[model samples]
Target: MPVSKRWTVEVLIGEDHGNTSAVARLDTNDGTHLVGAGQARLNPADDDIPAIGDELAAARALSDLGHRLLLTAAADVAAVAEQPVHLTW
Candidate 1:
């Protein structure tokens, strides 16, 4: 049997007080949802670059989302196998 499912991710950003923040939302067809957020700030001495902040915050949020998904999967596997599992990543 073959099964196909789709997942969607949305990233929202905000800027205020010389800081940029982003949130990434993950929606899975299996009814699992996850949210992650990250923030970046401009140093007083560093050049102000909105794009840099956007990229850093977005990447951090996405990375957090990925880690969470992996942890969930690991837990599911442990439940089925009837064994305690520890994830290190």
Candidate 2:
């Protein structure tokens, strides 16, 4: 079996002198339907605020997508395993 499903990821960041927020969205390959969105925020109090915000946002988005993929793969594997198979000698 082949998986015809594909996804795309996009990230947007907003920042002030000390505050930052980032939103990551995942859509279908066509970029029409949204599959998931992840958000992250950073305070100026943190070290390397901009970089930290970006890293957190990217990590959240990637983690979200990775979790989805893992679940889907597990379900497919389980389904295939449940199917009856016959062998002839």
Against the true structure, whose lDDT is highest? Answer: 1
Q: Judge candidate 1 at residue 87 and give its lDDT.
A: 79
lDDT of 1 by residue, 1-89 (tens): 67698789999999886799999999998899998888899999998989999999999899898899889988998999899888788
- lDDT, candidate 2, at 48: 62
| Model 2 ranges off by over 4 Å | 1-36, 83-89
Which candidate has the top score in TM-score?
1
Ten contiguous residues with the weakest lDDT in model 1: 1-10
TM-scores of the models, in the order given: 0.89, 0.50
Candidate 1 wrongly placed segments (more than 4 Å): 1-3
lDDT of 2 by residue, 32-77 (tens): 4333334566544566657776676667666766666556556667
